[model samples]
Target: MEAPLDPVSAETVSISADQRSRPYLRLFLISFVLLFAELACIRWFGSTVILLTYFTNIVLMACVLGMSVGCLAASRGRNWINAVLPLGLVAIGLACWTLQAYERGEMSIAAGDQSAPQEIFFGAESVQQAPLGRTYPIEVVAGLFYALIALMFVGLGQVMGRAFNAIPNRVAAYTTNVFGSLVGIAAFALAAALQTPPRVWFALALVPLLGFVTRFRPIQVVALVAILFLVGWLPPARNGAARQVTWSPYYKVVFQPSTAVIETNNIGHQQMASIGNSGAAYLLPHLLNRDAGGRPFEDVLIIGAGSGNDVQAALSQHAKHVDAVEIDPVMASIGRANHPNRPYDDPRVSLHLDDGRSYVRKTSKKYDLIVYALVDSLVLHSGYSSLRLENFLFTEQAYRDIQARLKPGGVFVMYNYFRQGWVVGRLVKMVEKAFHMPPIVISLPYRAKITPDQNQAGATTMLIVGKTEAATAAIREKLAESGAFWIHVSPAKNAALNGYGAKAPEVEGTMKEHWWKIAPSVVETRGIGPLPSDDWPFLYLRSSMIPGLNLWGIVIVAVLSLAILARFAPPATTRPNGRMFFLGAGFMLLETKGVVHLALLFGSTWIVNSIVFFAILVMVLLSNLFVVLVRPRRICWYYGLLIASLVIGAFLPMDSFLALPGASKVILSCAVTFVPIFFAGVIFATEFRDSRHPDVDFGSNIGGVILGGLSENLSLVVGFKHLLLLAAVYYLLSAAFKRRAEPPAS
Candidate 1:
């Protein structure tokens, strides 16, 4: 016998050929299963439950260990996998159990009106919530997941024994590692350019690249290029579809009041005009001057110090020192850079770059006057007046905390933008509870924008003055003088100001008015709604509609995606497999998810427009060029999936939970929206092996990512939630394709 014709070479060739088909089919199945799971879980449970699912990290670690052990046992022996399986399964069960808690809707903080501010210490037990999944805290779950993956890798490596020796030649290993690093660097760079904050999301997008590149197949490079492009292009592309079209950098500016200016660039114009007319500015000087008002306050605390107007009032008074806490770094920078009154430079003004609540915790310094000149409502980013953190900031506990920071003769003044709505009433009650004094609720009228009706809900900026002492004639006299100095808060009524006669409902300690209903009409108004043509979905869809000849600007992206995918394709083999498809799909999905989620949660007027017209094109070109140049293997797929899932599951659900009614509905929607994305990542991560021509696979995966981003933005025009269903259908189609292409089992 010809000694079996040295069949080892033939076997190697066959295996190499088969590898190309493996990943493609596997990814299709994986994506399908995951997508189905997402829809099913969300439909049944709700977003809250899905958000809570991050706590399942406890179980995931165990499951990973079990999976690793099982894989090891298949290769090494039964004993090893079996030994770890019990513990792993137990952990998985525990994770599932913990996730179930979201079903009960226990995530929201309890409503309370406890007065008399005391120090708050979250304590060991309360800190249990720390590791609970949410966007900000996703690191907790991601870090744990990574640790588990590392453990599994180490254990698996041990089981491989001699087989591990044949892993990669020096050249192959170095090349693969470099490719992997490049993929990671490219994905992160793309994510960063898009203004995506540090999270597991970037990691997940790179998972497929890691797996495909490891196969040493050139087609893997295409996957990397696709992913990068998807992320780079999707955001800008969405901007193209907006309805109202206008670009005004003036929208960002802050200016003084003037009717001559039909549209002022400055953001503070409306407030300034209202304040100026109300005679609040005139009275502010009087309140500050001790000789005039006999106001004994030596120091004052001001929050939301917009345009430094409040600081100017403080400077007028003989305040020993004034502490102002403003959250927006941009506002602070702008004030220092351009504001006539540089509060940062003011001798008496000590500017604090921190949230009001957080800053209060660190400071023991007492102030005679604490003025919360915050925008009538609390929204984190740029908005006229929002109710984002209103509950926390206006609570009884918060007021009491403010009281603790005040001196014996101190007064706490809150000027809120409130109509005679339930929000105002609740606020008054909450403040009364803290001080044990009836609020001297004075109505200051100004015509501001309203919700449901663009111009009319008759909103008035209400001044609810609370002091330790009763307001006598003398106090009223002092308040009148102080009101004159603060222009935004008026002492007089104008026709421009809306009426505030409607009685507001009372809010109790345990039983509170519904936030939405009682939420003041003032807060409901979408302050300066998203600018025309700046709608996120519109931008993406518009970009896509541009003709290729005109869209030739992103030529580099097209080239890169094709080039990378080409490089990864097995030159000698015909079939396409695991090393290719997963990377491609994962990349696209990552880009899509990030852009859509960001646009939805954060205000996207300027951002989406800018991305569509400018940033994305540059990113697409850069991503393509980068992939064509460098390639790596075993891209960080496992870690990426783990992180992406944690971020989406934890943070993304807040909107749905807030938007939807029932706990189950919220949880279920969240699960459906998130799970499919998570599973897509997992499939990509599962491919952690050496490959051929890592660059090609790298490019393909990246290109896919670019597509994913594009798809997300396009989905915006089609409908945000509807896109989730579309994603599911696409995954199913992919799965069917894979099943058809796959060979029959032995």
Candidate 2:
């Protein structure tokens, strides 16, 4: 009967008080579904799309942008809710098909990541690029997928927008939304915990989505089936090649038993074979360790011990105690079940399913030999940021920790097909800096095309670091005595070497020989380049700045986001609550800072991420309750508190906290990390309590999240600690922009 007033626009919803309970329940359900779907989209797209495995934040920002657009569309009475299924199918189907084409080497749909020597993308070079003018270049493929992912989630956002408008009490409605989102994140975490496949993720998301539809057409039914079927089994090349897919918390692990090879997120991860042929690379480090005089490394620690090839090699080398540390359980299980040598089943082998850095921090027993065996993570640590899982593992701080774990005069070996000279050179410098001695770096002598004067550059390189007097000296003496101890490379080229022998693998003739002692030439000549540290751990990046590909991607996303908002969002006749927008932006930063801060204190593991998300949500819930019950006044006071908290956090350094007692470090770290978030939540909840147009206002908030996600990239340059100051500025902007308005309706 009432043409209700929505202050932001002329649009009105004919919602009644009696309709509250069901609509609110539906709102909760819709929030749950959408959050779960968003998480699924991020994970699935990162794992399925070829180049996007390194672009998780793009997926995240797309979801935020989509939500903002869909929520704003709510006031226009346009419903994309029914389109969710079809859009989702299109997004998933497109990814699957593209991935199939990629797998078959039929197409190149990369994200302008190729030709990037400044950053390392594992499979970018292998992608067959289409000519720039002829085909829609693979670079644009990521943008297309970004739009598709955004479109897929627009329906969920629209439903939430509608539900928010249905309830008269804005605070209650928002609280419900937060609670629902909390549940949704938890649900996804549970799914991750269960190690559910993509099909189960789709099914879980589909159940709540059906509640939003007034009636289910046959098209919807078929689309639902298509979503499940395509996501579960499409990209037949991937499935058929692997025969089985295991969803780890961090990746889609494809174990190809027939080939004894493992792939994660569409990239070659590791191979499980004996020490005779392909596995000979693993035995090189042991052979190089001449401390026991051909007796082998007695106590070995292999970080990133994927599929037990190194462990197998260790046992073959007669390692008395082998501590094999692998981060992924699925990868470990694959090794245990199918590794030809059955390394994990060996009595002397102790497999630790934990982060390498964390394990190093906790382990007190020094190792006779330590190996970093092709330790590269194809995926980022958290979807919220552009940091890979292996970033921390390669930092100077990490190397120092490894040094502590190594027995005095013990050997530390790192080998990988570095592809770039700068990477190899950079690693050599970090090793020298940490171990206080130059490492014996064995790599084909070549200059980096991108980096100047990096001698020991491309191909498979081994860096042997040690205490000069004992293990390393023994190896150095062995190199001079008979030159038969070997590099971290076996004499058998492709064949796995059964044991040590005085045989050099044939090299391509008429090429320069490798330099066994790779000096820090670049560091001395050009001044040292930025080395990764705990504060700025970016192992793959050439420097602290964002890569060219990422910069271009960000610019395109910003432009597209503007265009989408201009086209689909509610008319710009009325001004949005700027405070809400900035508050949303600030909240995003706070959450990001909390995640990173805690990750530095704890390990960058999936469990840490889940707990941080849960804790942040819980903080929001508490803040909402405080807002409703306390009915706090003066948004300025809350802003002050938020800024104060951020300042306090900025002053507290991450590395300094590592020495604190375990419980004490966690308490102090979480407080510094989350206290600012609580204040931001309070400010948002308090202001939201009296909002005139819930849909428009909430949509504006989502827009801020997109900004925050974009702003997060600045951390690459400024580091995470300084982000606190940036967040503080945002809260200040939020406070400055706050409108003088009417008091509470009560």
Query: Which candidate has the highest TM-score of all?
Result: 2
Candidate 2 regions with alpha-carbon error over 4 angstroms: 1-18, 110-116, 128-139, 238-242, 291-295, 444-458, 481-528
Q: What is the lDDT of residue 707 in candidate 1?
A: 39
The global C-alpha lDDT for each of the candidates, from Candidate 1 onward, is 0.36, 0.75
Candidate 1's C-alpha runs over 4 A off are 1-251, 254-294, 333-345, 376-392, 446-460, 464-746
* Per-prediction TM-score to the true structure, in the order listed: 0.36, 0.90
- Tens digits of lDDT, candidate 2, 167-224: 7667778878988989989989999989999999989888668868765788888999
**Candidate 1, TM-score vs. the true structure?**
0.36
Query: In candidate 2, residue 264 scores what lDDT?
Result: 88
Q: On residues 1-746, what C-alpha lDDT tens digit does candidate 1 reach at each position?
A: 11121123333455664664443343332222222221222111111122222122222222222222222222333223112222222323333333333223232221011111010111111222323442223233323333333232222222221122222221222223233334434443343334342123322433332332223443344444443332222111111332111112112222222221111110112232232233353234234234233564578888767556676666654567889886544455555544544556878788875557545645778877777774422111111101122223454546667777877666677664332233444555556667776554443342222332232123334433434554223444444443321222332321122112122223232122221111122333222222112122221011223323212312433343334323322224423333334344433443344343433332223333234223323333333333333322323443354344544443433244323444664356435444544445333322322223222223223334333333443333433434443444334433333311111111
Highest lDDT: give the candidate number: 2
